[model samples]
Target chain A: MFSGSVWKNIAVLGIVALISGITVFTVHAITKGYIIKSESRYAKRFLFQVAPNANYTNDILTDTINIPKKYFSMLGIESGEIHLVKINGKLISIIVPSIAYDGYNGKIKILVGINLDGSIVSVRVVSHKETQELGDKMEVVKSDWILNFNKKSLNNLEPKSWKVKKYGGYFDQFTGATITPSAIIKQVHETLKYYEMDKSRIIKELDVFNEIKVSNNFEGGN
Target chain B: MYIRSYKSILNNGIWEENQGLILFLGLCPLIAVSNSVVKALGLSIATMFVLLFSNITISLIKKRVSGILKIPIFIIIIATFTTIIELFMKVFMYELYILLGIFIPLIIVNGLILNRAEIFACKNSVVKSAFDGLIFGMGFSAVLITLSAVREILSVGKIFINMDLLFGSAAVDWSITIFSEGYSFLLFMLPPGAFILLGFLIALKNLIDGKVNTLSGNERSSLKKETKRVRTTGPVA
Candidate 1:
């Protein structure tokens, strides 16, 4: 209660804090629109690549893939679920944005679209914090060998079958990127596992993704 | 406050008082975004604009600002101007804005701005501060553009022409080609390449300076010794 003048110090600090806060808020407001557009552009390639067989119009991220209300109960976001792409009244590829956390560095985000029979349409790396030369070679410009993954089936695929040739397995690792290719193979196997485990429910849930936006809007409004 | 001629002004930017290669200000963005010519150019232009405007404003208000609160007042003024340029980039060059990222916000830390505020802005008239800023901006841009050109040519195998995204239709075809076929030196675009190219560029600058010095009867001074002899600063390209 009898200190030397805390009020003066508090007032100065308060003014500085207020000014700094306002400046940050203003900078964010000024940059928000551009940042959103740029991020969307970066992510759009993933959706389109993974679902090449499907026709998408407008900003794809804004549109959602609808899971059937009947099958929605069986699927959890944290647990991973199944959904299908729907064009004007017909069904298309199944959309699967999967997180392969056991990647070379951090989680390698992959959006994989597969036909009901398990043929991959395409794959896109949404985010990956891989190693300098090894894991980063996953990019097409660097080590495009991942292109070999196309058109392969998993019916008789063995676990050991899903590994780098360095370990005497199927896939090839980058020049020095064994872990990256290995992680990719492991994640692909998991994606296939998830698809196979819930095939019947997923099959029943097909042709419902077109209504995703409507459901989302209804939920948001409430 | 008194720049006698063009040579003196050029000397101010290029040597006696440099924003980067000499002054050592703005090293953060200089290192972060020098991976390509387009990005470096985008950031250089933005910084130039901010430096020019803030110098003018600070010089105008130098007399009015109290000694007790000059730094805070100076920061407020610079931040106001920096935000304006950031908004312009966001609206007009969205792709460039995205590539520059957080480094744009970090421009507030750039010592070039503060150096001018403390040195020229606090003492000079508005017109002189503006000239100093303009020369400093040119020097910074020259270094940035040259460094980015070298990087993009070696790493990306191409230079410029993301114009549809950065400058809209007008800049389409504005990009020039340095190569004809597949000849990318990928390592040049990496962060390590930044250090390598920067080392080589500084060496080049020293070589040129040595030649100039030799012509002026100072051939005894070695270029290696010259660069090392002096403390350098931001926009280090």
Candidate 2:
């Protein structure tokens, strides 16, 4: 017990590190598949809520298009993924993950689903840090305020009508939390505008992507 | 190092040296996650898992490690168990994992786990250390669950409202609404409320301890002895 050599301490430390590292690695390897599956299942649950009407046979979790960094500011997100909903191999709708940087407490992440006609299928807040009793009404579990965005589109509402009623707009704002609703209204409007501007390019990219996937499967089958 | 009886060790963990109320260790996650019973329960189970395994592992290896190397070795073991629990939670309890967020990884830094490993587990047998871990974990969880229940009831006017987040769909209807909709006290949901409630809880515990002592007939002398014992920190006697 009196051996206090420096090398001994280092060797003991090394052995402990190696053993603990192996233990963690083994657990991670065992749970990796279930982790991935659970994550996808969670994502799919939200995706379906956003696009309930889409009769897509494809796996929408991986059917995603990455938004270019140039448009990040417009979408209020650092990075973005747009999930394409397909029915019988046809692009039916797209669920875009957007963020509202102007939320009362940091950002509010949402999934906005838009049909091919540019109308909103639905919108669901993925996560947010808004005030508990005030701004949190935006959550579907908390209130129906979020569902008010459904079936609305740019064609119907004037550009000025996008803001909350407090800002001289068509949408109603939470009495005690104007900023929360206004921020979401603005973000949803921007999401609609982004969908309109990128529709053609999005469809073209999907077509190219599907063709490559089909070709890859063809080669693998032979 | 000295050995303690199983009953004394259990009492030391759950009451005499209660990590939450007496030691005041790991208050960061306690305050952050105790707003909801489901969240508190999720973190409690995760922390208890890490603490139990880390204690057993450290006790098993204490003989080989000596001097300054012990702390780092203990940390590595604790972190390995924490990561394993985090991975399992992400796989099996996905919703709770998301709700708990960064706090799960932050379990590695929880002072309670490190304190147990250093002050008790390193000097004890594997079974004793495991018992210590389990009891201390229960002590901490008791505080968290109680705080969360009070907060949930006061702030949201409901108990177990989001039980499904932890127990799956079967618990969806387990919640009990004490007050009608829109009847909430927002203060209890905030951080300051946690501090206020925790203070009252400590006061109540002290009051109870005083009452028990007097009822046992030892009175003031035993109370003084108890405080003196708590004051003498470090490894158990």
Interface RMSD of each: 5.5, 0.9
Candidate 2 residue B141 Cα shift, in angstroms, is 0.6
Give the range of the ten consecutive residues with the poorest summed lDDT in model 2 chain A. A1-10
What value of lDDT does candidate 2 attain over all alpha carbons?
Answer: 0.90
lDDT scores for all predictions? 0.69, 0.90
* lDDT at position A107, candidate 2: 83
Model 1 Cα shift for residue A148 (angstroms) = 2.8
How accurate locally is residue A120 in candidate 2, as Cα lDDT from 0 to 100?
Answer: 95
Question: With candidate 2 superimposed using the best TM-score fit, by how many Å does residue A14's alpha carbon deviate from the native?
Answer: 0.8
Which prediction has the highest DockQ against the true structure? 2
Give the per-residue Cα lDDT of candidate 1 at A161.
Answer: 81
lDDT of 2 by residue, B145-174 (tens): 999999999998999988988888999899
For all the predictions, what are the DockQ values?
A: 0.13, 0.77
Best by TM-score: 2
**Model 1 DockQ class:** incorrect
